[model samples]
Target: MQDFLFYFLSALTLISGLMVPVSKNPVNGAMYMILCLIGTAGLFALLGSYFMAALQVLVYAGAIMVLFIFIIMLINAPAETKRKRDIPSLIAAAIAFLMLTVGFVMMAMSPELNQPMPALEDAETLAAEGAIPFDGSAKSYGFGLYGKYMLPIQVMGFLLLAAMVGVIHLSKDLHARSQAMLKVKENASE
Candidate 1:
């Protein structure tokens, strides 16, 4: 079941990642990117890193994606028009793909990768020995972030807030200019 899930999530991540660049509509591409992020979060979850999964979903899929879509809409990006693919470019792409495939195959067949990984130290044992255990769990991650990294987190929040305000101000200025243009055109017609 775990293997099946891993494969499913991997496929989801790959396909969504591919679609993000290939999609004709910018909004659709953003949506696909969100899916890719979500799939990545799932993969993280499968690896028992709940904190990373949550961060991936919250930061990348939710907040970042919303910001991206908002900016995309604000810019009024047009949907991509289909273009004719030239043969040379197609051949070049194929060659690049082939090279990438060969690289992966070689890496997978490397002798170093086939060796057994060293076992990790037991978290409880380390803690009992009066050493700090760096177990990658959500509880520990949250505690560390909120406890030790509080100031940095707050600073980042403020930075993001400032950015949001700036975007809003810029959008308002653009709206005002557009309104002025319409008024000028109306007066000229009369």
Candidate 2:
């Protein structure tokens, strides 16, 4: 039963993840991403990390995807016209695909990948000895995030803010350029 669920969730994650990149509509792509995130949460649940699974569902599948869809709605991007694929682009894509395949194969072949996890008793012993930190609760995650990982989290927040500002600036510039183009066209027409 566990194996069946693992395979099902894995397939769901993989298929939706692939569809996210392939979907032509931005909204559809975002929806696919939500599905992928949910599948990831299911995988986390299967791994017995229920807190992480809930966090994944709430933060990523819920809030982040909502933000993404909101941004897409605001942007209201026009449909992209079909363009002919060139040989150079095709070659580059093929090379990229081959590299990804080779990387996956190498990772799968690694000795460390075959190692089994410790048993439940061993994990409990390690936790009792304060070695593994596997209390398996939201408190542990919160402490790790706010205590040891504080600096990295702050840096990530700062980077995200910077990116948001950059995006807003770029959008304003694009708007100004479009207005200028419109004025020029009107003047020429007159």
Q: Against the true structure, whose TM-score is highest?
A: 2
Q: lDDT tens string, model 1, 127-184? A: 5564445565767777777987899999999998999899888767787899999999
lDDT of 1 at 36: 94
> Candidate 1's error at 57, in angstroms?
0.2
Per-residue alpha-carbon lDDT of candidate 2 for residues 88-163, written as tens digits (9 for 90 to 100): 9878988998999899989988998967666655665566553446645888788888887899999999999999
Query: Candidate 2's C-alpha lDDT?
Result: 0.87
- Global lDDT of each model? 0.84, 0.87
Regions of candidate 1 where Cα sits further than 4 Å from its true position: 86-90, 115-134, 142-190
Runs of candidate 2 with Cα error greater than 4 angstroms are 127-132, 150-190
Candidate 2's error at 68, in angstroms? 1.6
